[model samples]
Target: MADPTPAEVQSYIEAGLPCQSLSVEGDGRHFFATIVSAEFEGLTRIKRHQRVYAALGERMREQIHALSMKTLTPAEHGATQ
Candidate 1:
């Protein structure tokens, strides 16, 4: 199977997770995403990653391989900006 594009990855996450803002950049095999969501509030880093993985679901195992993410709550994201 052909590797998925960054846009495709972005959509995959969006389809499953509710994000305040999200962006993805990748070269098929690996991806980096900055995801901001209210759902991340009070969650630990690992839990935040788990949530994103849950959002990706089967695709995380099937299509995308390596994903490096900056998961943030709206407040955290805003502070970073």
Candidate 2:
């Protein structure tokens, strides 16, 4: 299978998770994402990543090679901006 594009990965996440804001940047094998969502509000960092992984599902293992992400709640994201 071909590696997913950043747009494809972004769509995959959006399909499964509700996001206030999300952006992904990557080459074929590696990706970095900044994801903002209400669902991450009370979750730990690890759990937040887990939520994104769950959204990716089998695609995470079969297509994408690596993903490094910044996961944040809407409030947290707002604070950073």
Pick the lDDT winner. Answer: 2
lDDT tens readout by residue for model 2, 9-78: 9999999999999999999789999999999988999999999999999998899999999999999988
Model 1 worst lDDT run, 10 consecutive residues: 72-81
**Alpha-carbon runs more than 4 Å astray in model 1:** none
State how far residue 60 of model 2 sits from its true place (Å): 0.9
Predicted candidate 1 versus true structure: per-residue lDDT over 42-78, tens digit per residue: 9999999999999999888899989999999999888
How many steric clashes does model 2 contain?
0
Task: State candidate 2's TM-score.
Answer: 0.97
- Where is model 2 more than 4 Å wrong at Cα? none
